[model samples]
Target: MADLRVELCGVSLKNPVIPASGTFGFGREYNEIYDIARLGAVATKGLTLLPRPGNPVPRIAESRGVILNAVGLQNPGVESFIKNDLEWLRSKTKVIANVAGSTIAEYGEICARLDGLVDFIELNISCPNVKCGGMAFGVRPESIREVTAEAKKNCPHTPLIVKLSPNAESIPLNARAAEEGGADCLSLVNTFTGLAIDIERRRPILANNTGGVSGAGIKPIAVRMVYEAARAVKIPVVGMGGIACAEDAVEFLTAGAAAVQVGTANFGDTRACLKIIEGLNEWCDRHGVSKVSDLTGTLVPNA
Candidate 1:
């Protein structure tokens, strides 16, 4: 048997196969399909200070090998999650509360609300700030630092994992900004900004016009960004983009990710994470690798 455990920011996971935020929901629905305990951790849907109804109809549309979603961070508010879902989720497996907010105060307050309650607090700066005229806090490195710092200040007891947006001008720069702002760990390659048009209607498929893209089509680009951010930051990097199988997860590990998050694949196969875990073990055994962590950043350049 191979060792599959991974430790990030002092939290030890049974394995490195976490489910990305917004994709896994609160875990109750998926738990009906498979044991939620089987996962390393579950990054819950992006939560805010207040609940959001999300965008209009047609928020999700499928591309050739990818998916575009402008769910608009729709989720139950932070207080509701604490009052209803927090304890049950913690009892099942590790919890990474994925948080989103419009202002620095909102971020701090939500983090404070979740502080000392969950296993980790994942700061999500990707959602648009209505007050800022629809600008996402994540697109700018400066805002990334500011938001990370504020959230860190409030969530002093829990480790902070800042999720970076791929839409940024420089991923590594934003990663460094997070570290500078006191991020204990970082997760990257959040869905890319994309859109699809309906030829017949001659309009955007998504009601919001633009949406975040994810799935197998994004694997290579995500791997590249993971490599860049990993090299630039001292903190651990949790990579996720288009990982659908064990080999795909290994690619991110080799690209310098401390762990990998399984996203859109879960939509297709409810048991995707479990299968990927099995695949990781099989691959490790076949390659004579004793520990999965040994594969991190093990990629060799072509001679």
Candidate 2:
């Protein structure tokens, strides 16, 4: 069997497949289907300093090959998560705490609170559908640097990962900024800002009017952006967007991602992550690849 183990910022993962934040939701629900410990890591839903009720109704809208979400950052406060979900999840597998805030100070507060409690603290700076500080800090390279630095300072014991937004001016620039600001790792292409309209109603499907777009439709663009950002930064990059299967996961690896995150696919199939993991093993065995990590950054540019 091929070796599927990979490391991110010195933390070793059993494999490179992680359930993206917001999609896996602390792994309790999924645990009913399979052992959560079988996967590489579980990224918790976006956590805030205080509990958030999120946005209004019709938060999720489906379209051809993709989905739009304005779910906001609806999550139990960090305190509740620490008390409720933290240890249970940690015992299952590696825990990556996905956190968000409405202010730069709040980012530090949450990071500090979760410091040493989770394996990784993923800073959610690129949520497009939110009305507050999410996308605001992610759009510019300057703020990406500033907010990342603040979060990193607060969480010295845990690895800090800055999740970059696809709605930014330049993926490479924002990636470099996070690297400069002390991000131990980077994850990208967090949903593109998109709008879906109801033809008969002549109104946007989501109550927020606009939402972050994700799913299979964003794969190509996500792969390209991942390639660009990976080339720009020295730190490890975790690629995500529209990944659905093992082949999709391999594409991100070839594009320079140390690992990949599965998001919307989980909505359609509960076993998507596990299937991808099994598929990866099969694919590697068939291709004669001894270690899956060898596939990273193996893309050869067209001459």
Candidate 3:
């Protein structure tokens, strides 16, 4: 049998197959389909200081090989998650509380609340920073550093993982900003900014007009960005975007990701993560590999 264990920022995961935030939804509904604990970790839905109803109707639309979503960080408040789902989720597997905020102070407050409780706190600074003149904190290197530093200050007991947005001008620069700001690890290639129009209506399908694009179509771009970010930062990188099978996960690992996360794939198959985990194990054994972690950043340039 091959060893699949991987340690990132002092946290040991049984493997390196985490479910991305906004896709996993706290692992409750999926838990009914299979034992989620079999995976490495679960990054819960993006939570905020207050509850958000999310965008209007048609928040999700399917394109050729990808999906567009304007969910708008809709999630129950932080306090509610702790009061209801925290203990149960913690009992199942490692918990990475994906947090979002409208302001830097809100990020700090939420991080402080979940600091000692969850296994890790992942900062989702991709949303608009109301305090910073409506700019996304994750878009600019400066805001990424500032927001990460503020959040890190509140989560002393918990490791901080900064989730990066691909819409940035420079992924590596933004990644370095997070690392310098005290992030223990980083998750990259958040949904790409995209749009889908209804030809008949001659309007956008989503009320928000634009949404985050994710799915199989994004694999190539996501892989490229992950490679760039991994090369720029010493901290471990958790790569996501269009990982539907073991091969896709392997691609991300070789490209320089410490681990890979499955997002839209779960929507298609409730047991997607489990299947990928099993596939990874079988592939490792067939390849005569002792541990899967050895594959991280193992890509060789073409001669």
Q: TM-scores across all candidates?
A: 0.97, 0.99, 0.97
- Between which residue pairs do clashes occur in model 3? none
Name the candidate that leads on TM-score.
2
**What are the lDDT scores of the predictions, listed in order?**
0.89, 0.94, 0.89
Local lDDT at 7 for model 1:
94
Q: Once model 1 is optimally superposed onto the true structure by TM-score, how far is the C-alpha of residue 1 displaced, in angstroms?
A: 1.4
* Residue-by-residue lDDT tens digits, candidate 1, 39-132: 9999999888889888787989999999998888788798899999999999988999998877789889999998999999998876432333
Report the C-alpha lDDT of model 2 over 1-303, residue by residue, as the tens digit.
899999999999999999999998889999999999999999999999899999999999999999999999889899999999998999999999999999999999999999999999999999886778999999899999999999999999999999999988889899999999999999987999999999999999999999989999999999999999999999999999899999999999999999999999999999999999999999999999999999999999999
The lDDT leader among the candidates is 2
Runs in model 3 deviating more than 4 A are 128-135
Residue pairs with colliding backbones in model 1 are: none
The stretch of ten residues in a row with the least summed lDDT in candidate 2 is: 126-135
Q: Is candidate 2 or candidate 3 better by lDDT?
A: 2
> Which stretches of candidate 2 lie above 4 Å from their native place?
none
| lDDT (C-alpha) at residue 160 in model 3 | 98
Q: TM-score of the candidate numbered 2?
A: 0.99
Task: Tell me the tens digit of each residue's lDDT in model 3 across 1-303.
Answer: 788899988999999999989898989899988988898999999898889787787889999999998888778899899999999999999999999888889889999999999999999876431233123788899999999999999999999999998888999899999999999999987888888999999999988888888999999999999999999999999999999999999999999998899999999988889989999999999999899999999988789
